[model samples]
Target: MWTAIAGGIQYIIDMGASVMLPIFVAILSIIVGVKPGKAIRSGLILGVGFVGLSLIVNLMNDQLGPAAEAMSQRFGLSLSIVDIGWPGMSPITWASELAIIAIPLAIAINVVMLLTKLTRVVNIDIWNIWHMAFTGVMAYAVTGNIWIGVLGTAVHAVIAYKLGDLMAPMMVDYYELDGLTVPHGTSSYLAPVAAVVDFIIDKIPGLNKIDFNADTLQEKVGVLGEPVVIGFILGAAIGFLGGYAPDQALPLGINMSAVMVLMPKVVKCIMDGLMPLSERAKKIMNEKFSGESFYIGMDPAILLGDSQVVTAGLIFIPITLLIAVLVPGNRVLPFADLATIGFFIAGAVAVHKGNLFRTLISGILIMTLTIWIANQTVDWVTAIGVTTGSIQAGSVIAALDQGGCPISYVFTQLFTMQNVTGLVVIGVLYAICMVFYVNLSKKRAAALEAEDDEE
Candidate 1:
């Protein structure tokens, strides 16, 4: 009974998400010949007609309707399909336990990760975040254990956004331009240079005393936000130089520094907000944001062609660490964490990082895979598909009437000899898709080059 209710609710959520997918896809599809409003309305109508009503009603008929009818015959209380909306006992006990455990424990784990420098170098962003929350929600829906779901969702979301993305200064640059990207162009060659500098900084005896809180993301924003934080930092610096100044006005460029640092955020919050109403709003927004994609960054002027791999690798560390360690309990998952990491390494080893173009292609390939996985998994999955061939109704009814293995569970086993065959199937499908994409890209490149030579 509890299983029925949990499955029904989760199924509704999944169906709703699926219903919304067409709307989102249609909105994007407006660029390709469809009228946005018309496409949206049509999609919504079809979703309602086919999925919202028909699919669900049929599913309910197959599952709960049969069970309810059987119970009616036994107990002698007649109930219609409409009277019993969904079959299954409410999981009251399951939800009660989730709330108690998730909040405090997730917070504690996030704090620990922060102090230990686990996500220090990673760039945090919105996309990285959506995964953890989604994971948490799915985990609960699947397990029917509220605590597991709560813990998975809340912990995954907070640490990912806060310690991982928010506190880190590099996130601003990476997210605005290249969230979870690799380094490209001449900058690609400079990774080794930066690595050496970071190593030297770590070794500095007195310099090291100043705990370089890889807290640059927050500090940068704070010092740049209102000018007050920067003023305080600057005022402290001036006081440190008291011996040189003594009594003369060593007032020293404090306010000016504060304003300059804060100029961008101030504009973003105030001017940009107001600009939407200004005569130039559309032009400014489109010019700034629409011309290039989100990962591509602010303006092409600063787009170093080869940075995607390094940026991706840095951010990939957190994602990889969390996914592999927490999910499968395998702490050793590395480049494979990046959807395209293995392919890039194969190509790089074949040539070198000096092959910047190939590296960039590899980086794009990986990011695409990440996007695909997110898209596929973002929707809720409710219907546990099943099939049956009944024997003579009188003979076989009793076997099904008693408690037995769910047909879905049997289907699960037939596919995989081990547990969670669903996850294994998904992994295999993704690998096949990646190979197909890579081959297609190689073909397109060859075709384009041949045409260019002829012209």
Candidate 2:
């Protein structure tokens, strides 16, 4: 009886402030009417929140004896803290957190909003569905071996972005409050167009700085051309059988990172090193500089409504091919790069909805965003003292891997000396591309600006 009593007492405490959740929701709901952010508790945001909390608290408790499980309990709330794909809680982790926050917040806010005549519940997200979706796709595509987490991010972002919009009757989400008036769940369908924008931006480095107007996303998708035609055939053949970097039939450990992501960056970097003249990309020995773009792309907001999936796919293929060749033997048949292949295939089939330049300029955007995201990832890892080496021992820790990616199960088998060998090989290849790309980009930029001026 005494034991039962203690157990029950612990349960009560573990429930923590959940009992007061309604009151908390009520208070927040009242305040959210006046403050926008106070009303939005999304999954993407939670992904960062959970992971950050887990890391800090786990570190606070010295790694929490193999993944912390009681951090939320301290608050009398049941929290299942774990490693997200990145440094924070992932979709699953955020799901648990969102359940705790969203429902209560919804009830509180909904009740208040209804009473105050603030809204009628039509949408959920405040804005930027395209940004959420594009980032989701990009992150998922580049996650390499951690595909499940990538998918989870996709699902969570989509759901969280429109949670209130879809379940308006029950949720005090954006739709219910009428505060969210962006797009709905159709963002994924438009991913192909977004993909096109990404590819275009990447091709022409700084071009993205001046052109975020992706209004032609749909129109870009509509044009069924060689790039998309070939890309679709190739992507369909690839399917979802392989991941970002699958181990090849050979004994060699293929460091897909080297070829898949790093190789291209290296080549581009080398080209950057050799490029002729760009005020920012190149400087004559010692020169003052400002990070501002030569121009800013139109707001991405205007572009999202008009884009489609086909154009995004067309842009996806060739770029995918570049990375594909670098990592060819690892899982070559194209089935391995489903996200990328899917992108190309879908993009080819999509219809262009706006202008040609919108599609053309996407490549530059991809390059810029990739650089920012890569740097941010590095900064996050550095902050936690966890580097590629710390986690690269090729030993599988089930606890460390939330999802069951086969390669993840055998770390050493996957991350062996092969990583070192592949890096060396690709490093040489990237150096070559770098030299070429840098010069081409510079000349192209000058010519394009002149052309634009003439137009």
Compare the candidates by TM-score and give the number of the best one: 2
Off by over 4 Å in 2: 1-90, 95-99, 106-121, 124-308, 317-357, 378-455
Runs off by more than 4 Å, candidate 1: 1-106, 115-131, 154-267, 270-455
**Model 1: how far residue 138 lies from native, Å:** 1.0
- Summarize candidate 2's per-residue lDDT along 221-270 as a digit string, tens digits: 55433332333332332221122122221111121111222222332322
In candidate 1, what are the lDDT values of residues 1-455, reduced to their tens digit? 85576555444433442343344334433543455665565445434433432332243234323332333344443221111111110111112333234334444554465456443222211112223333343445445555555555464444332322221122232323222222211122112222222334347776534431113323557644333443334333333332224222123224323322333333233222221122222233236545421221111112222223222222232233233223322212222122222212222211222233333333343333332232222111121100011122222111100001121122222333344554556445434443443343244335545866999
In model 2, the number of clashes is: 63
* Local accuracy by lDDT, each model: 0.30, 0.28
Q: Which one wins on lDDT? A: 1
Q: For candidate 2, give the lDDT.
A: 0.28
The CA lDDT at 82 in model 2 is 23
Clashes of 1: 26
TM-score for all models, in order of appearance: 0.24, 0.26
Error of 2 at 295 (Å): 33
